[model samples]
Target: MAEDLVLDTAIRDWVLIPLSVVMVLIGVLRYFVSKLMRSSQSPDAKIIKEGQVIIRARNLRAGANFIPPKSFRARRAYFSNEENGLLFVPKGQAQNAQAQMFSDPNMAMDMMKKNLSMIIPQTLTFAWVNFFFSGFVAAKIPFPLTQRFRSMLQNGIDLSTVDVSYVSSRSWYFLNLFGLRGLFSLILGEENATDDTQRMMQMSGFGFDPSKSLGAEKDGLDIVQHEWALPKFEQRAEAVLKKLVS
Candidate 1:
């Protein structure tokens, strides 16, 4: 059995406290910088209308069973009609819309701004941690961890004997990088650009595609089998009333 390593009190005061404070401050700074750099382009009217249509279609699908069958059919047809439905965009039009989006200089510039905001601070912070606190054990978690967590928590150190709970300076920086989202939300409100996790996800091809979303909503509306539930609800209500009366 390996004995627990005794960390210095100064490590907590200097390494741990400063790293956390710097990370929080960087997040706040990044949020403000991104906000200032963001473009103030007004959304296209056509796109807004399409989004609203998709929402209306989704609501219709969710409550289809509650509405009369004829009404449901009419609503579904309005969205998913093969000939001229609101959701049925021509292949050419979809392609052109996507092409237009990619062709816009403002869109490209906005993407570049977002990338800069995410990357510049991250590079600086990582460099700062590596330069100042490389290979130093910053702090240990209060709970035990398995060997599986050793690689994740002990990034800068290369010791097989070290316990998995011991967090190195570099690893602590990363942990705070991804884990401070909730704190940022508390400080900056929801959907703030301070979260690096979202930026990472966006970089990995998870960004929204309006054409794909609209197509998916149209398909969802098409597959829903509407059935009226009013009669069944009425029967249940009558039975409950009789039970109460008796």
Candidate 2:
């Protein structure tokens, strides 16, 4: 068994602590910068109505059992009616809308802003860590890890003898980069733009698809088995009252 290496206390104070603090500060800064850069374009009235329709459909599906049968059927028809329902878009229209959304200059500009916000800080931070804190073992994990983790935990270090549990300075920075999401969420709100993983996912084409979302909501509303529970509740209340009287 390889002996545990005693890391210097200075490494923790100077490298690890400062690196964590810098990363956090950078994330907060990025959030504010992105917010400031965000365009205040007025949303299209049609888009707003479509979004509201989806919301109403979702609410109807969720609370269908609470409403009267006639009311439930009416609401479901308002959304999923084959002829003129709000959610029933003709097949090719949805594709055309998606294409138009992709071609919108404002959307392209907003995407560019988002990309710049995420990319600039990440590139700078990575460069800073590589230049100053390269090849230093900043910290070590308390629990033992297998050799498979060595490449992940000791990114800048090139030591075969070093324990896999020891984290290199560069690795520590990268870990803080991704792992501080919960911390950022706590500091900034849940919807803040400081989450790199989410931004990356969005960039990789996992972004919101309004047409698909509407279609899904429509399908969900269509399948809801609404059983009016108000009458059942009223009957139960009457039974309880009768029991009390008896």
Candidate 3:
């Protein structure tokens, strides 16, 4: 009887525990899959009655895929009274069918499937290794290290570089991925810069300073006014005019 009990206990520890772990792992995966599918099913657009303004999406496909709000950079008229006259136009061709790819559920699903195939196996391998030697992973990766990684993945760039340049008024139109405008747009509230200002800043990044680069005059306006012309030139002009009149 004692020998039988010892064998039973050893079998339970070696077999039962691992089996239970595998079952729990399967259950967690199922739950996540269901949740992700449900999230993908929801409508991408929702209108709320926040105030008097009735907001409508101008571009449906662009609106669906995390596209930034419409900017008024291009509509800038040479002589316009309106503030948004010198508006910024966001970059990229909104007319192209490819631009609307992200809005399609099938495309998003396909992309996600491909991404998961690339990520899941590696993540599971890491998790299994970590489970076998728990303290080793935790000790090697401190809280601060993980925090920095998360911050970078989410924010991408630091706020310290924001004030480095005076963004231009027009560059805000091309504020997509080509320009750092897309990254800066992720910041909230007051952190966001106007299209013109951001464009100026972008120009500044290219070693262009509109404020100081003007060559003494612009558009026929002499920046440096030479007050009180030479006395000789003034006398000569006056004498010539008097002789002509006489």
Candidate 4:
């Protein structure tokens, strides 16, 4: 068995502390960069108009049952009419099918700019730290971990006999990348786009999948799954009133 390797105070002060600070500063920097770039990149007007139409249609449908039949019918016609519906246009004026490849290019561009802001800072920071700070055991976890985690936890350190609980400088960079997002959020307001954590989470299974969202939305809109309420509501109200009277 190897001797217990103790971390020095200097290593903790220099490597561990600076790495965490750099992570925070970089996160702040990335947030500002994303905001600046996004401000310069105005969204396509057509796309905004389409988004507004979809949202308005969704809202109209959601509240349709609450309104009078005439109002509902008018709105329905506005949505489903073959002549002049918001959902449809004359075939001669219709957009080319190929142009709808990505239903929202603005979203795609936003994703790209946000990603570039995050990736560049992260890559440059990781490379800088790893080059300068490799081969140092920064700290140790209180809990014991298995051999499977050895490479992941102790990335830069190459001690075959060392315990897996010991964390290396290089591994700290990655751990910090996901961890400091909360700190970034606390310091920067919610609207600030500095933290990539949400984007990263979206990349995970729970977040937005462009392939699934628009197609699923279109499919959902087609079916609506809502039985038109006004058609049978009068009969339901009369039946309830008769029961109450009896």
What do the candidate models score in CA lDDT, each in turn?
0.84, 0.84, 0.32, 0.71
Best by the TM-score measure: 2
Query: How does candidate 3 score on lDDT?
Result: 0.32
TM-score between model 2 and native: 0.83
The sequence of per-residue lDDT tens digits that candidate 3 reaches over residues 24-109 is 44434533443354334443231122110111212222232232222211111211213321111123332333333334666457
TM-score to native of every candidate shown: 0.76, 0.83, 0.19, 0.72
Q: How far is candidate 3 from the true structure (C-alpha RMSD, Å)?
A: 24.0
Ten-residue segment with the worst summed lDDT in candidate 1? 200-209
CA deviation > 4 Å runs, candidate 1: 1-6, 142-165, 194-212, 232-246
Clashes of each: 0, 0, 19, 2
Say what the RMSD of model 4 is: 6.4
Order candidates by TM-score, high to low. 2, 1, 4, 3
Q: Kindly list the per-residue Cα lDDT of model 1 for residues 22-130, writing each as its tens digit.
A: 9999999998898898889888787788889888888998999999988988888888898899888778676655666666677668777888998899999999999
Candidate 4: segments with Cα more than 4 A from true spot: 1-3, 89-115, 191-246
Tens-place lDDT digits, model 2, residues 29-84:
99999889988988878778889988888778888999999988988888889998
Worst 10 residues of 3 by lDDT: 46-55
Model 2 residue 135 lDDT score: 87
Each model's RMSD to truth, in Å? Answer: 4.1, 3.1, 24.0, 6.4
Candidate 1 global Cα RMSD: 4.1
lDDT, candidate 2, at 92: 77
Greater-lDDT candidate between 2 and 4 = 2
